[model samples]
Target: MEGQAKGLLKLINEKGIHRNTKFLAIASGKGGVGKTNFAVNLAYILANDFDKKVLLIDADMGMANVHILVNVNTKKTLKDILNGERIEDIIFTTRNFDVLPGFSGIDAINEIDDSAVYKLVQNLNDISENYDFVLIDTSAGIDNKVISFIRASSKTYVLTTPEPTAIMDAYALIKSMKKLYDYSNFKIVVNMVKNEDEGIETFERLRSSIKKFLDIDVQLAGVIPLTKNLQKTVKKKQIISEVYPSDKFVLHLKKIAASEVGEPAPEIKEGFWDRVVSFLRKEG
Candidate 1:
């Protein structure tokens, strides 16, 4: 399966590995914020609709679900990579984007060391060089692993809902990450919104809290309204964008892509893996 996945990625990317890949980390303050759902759909749109090569990295560790959302069987995972398997070899190719499935559980996840993190970064950077975009679906909550992934990505998106607890959790995540790197590439996406006005108000509330308390501002990427059809697609293990392209949810996500992800980012001297190494050093 590993070899097959790499071969499939090669077929999609005939030019082989190259630099200039954009790393975008998607996180939720707490679970059930639709973080994985958003990541899967966004990756699908980029690869299937826009005709770009994309890799979706499931960094949720023990609670990986990107494969479940896409209904693909994964015989290998990041655990294999940590045990000396090449990062490129563990990829599980789906219909649209290639998925590097996160491990169900590994003791290392509870006690991962600097060398291990460095190894993951090195291998991820090696394979990520072949794509136009790499979407990291980070684990829920504000653990060290989740924080590390968010801080290392070129862009960070914090997912939230209109619920008060969810809003506070999102603010907490931003505060914790800001203490680490003072990242300016952060954005907010409000999901499961009931209406546009509610979404705007929710974002404004969160933004106000951050500004008044943390003295920093975050951009609102887009709002995804709750739709019954979205759940239907989830049950079917298919991307809502493909099954219901005309949905308001799909339309809003497209707006997010247009915001900045519609094309590859300009090349930079330092790359995603380099950023991870630097972040881990500071984290230590």
Candidate 2:
């Protein structure tokens, strides 16, 4: 353990090492929207498709399951570090991913103390130099801790489903952050869609509401089609990208990763989400 910690520390402290590290925070307007799945797959694709070093951080304080989703049993998490355990000690490695899993049984770290939250993110940002990208998977809700994580990140992805409640929640999350931190660097990912058209329409409706009322722009990053493979992989505790690289979900994810790392330029459309959705669906 001590040796591993030392190695991890060295990886972080070495200057000009892994110079491409970009911190991205993935959040959902509501739960069960597949934000964690997107985070895990995007990190893997960035590493495999783009061949960039990637590190996944489970920033969801009270409820973390990235390890469970990826089928790794962990003995430590980010909470252990915040509680005085060494940050390097909590680091864990999987077959294709390295992760800093969040605390266990921590349903409400927001109630813990503001200083602890500050210190946690500070330590995280400090040792982030080792990887090319640091993907933070946060919990649902726009609480203080989640907002802080979103604020500290260089970029953010706000995830949602096609449900009305989910869209409202997504809007609430974005609006709340704008009010709190004037956060504007955000993108939207419509998950679990039946097709690209559904994804685009869902993205458009939410995009229009936020723009009309909040006066903020949320980019539609892309949409993930609802796939049984994604659901099955999670049930079996494996990554779909590892099990089924040819799946359409993986393909879209690769496209998303390419855009993130500059391999492919993302298509940008301007208009209310409803119009974008209608146009894409009709074309489909």
Best by TM-score: 1
Model 1 root-mean-square deviation: 6.2
* Model 2 lDDT per residue over 76-131, tens place: 87777668777787887665568887775444453446576556556665567567
How many residue pairs collide in each prediction?
Answer: 0, 3
In terms of lDDT, the best-performing candidate is 1
Worst 10 residues of 1 by lDDT: 103-112
**Lowest lDDT block of 10, candidate 2:** 267-276
For model 2, the superposed segments whose C-alpha errors exceed 4 Å read 1-14, 17-20, 82-84, 104-123, 263-284
List candidate 1 stretches off by more than 4 Å.
1-18, 105-120, 262-269, 277-284
Local distance difference test values of all predictions, in order: 0.82, 0.76
Encode model 1's per-residue lDDT on 92-133: one tens digit a residue.
778668999887643454467768777877787778778888
- Give the local distance difference test score of model 2: 0.76
Q: Estimate each model's TM-score.
A: 0.86, 0.80
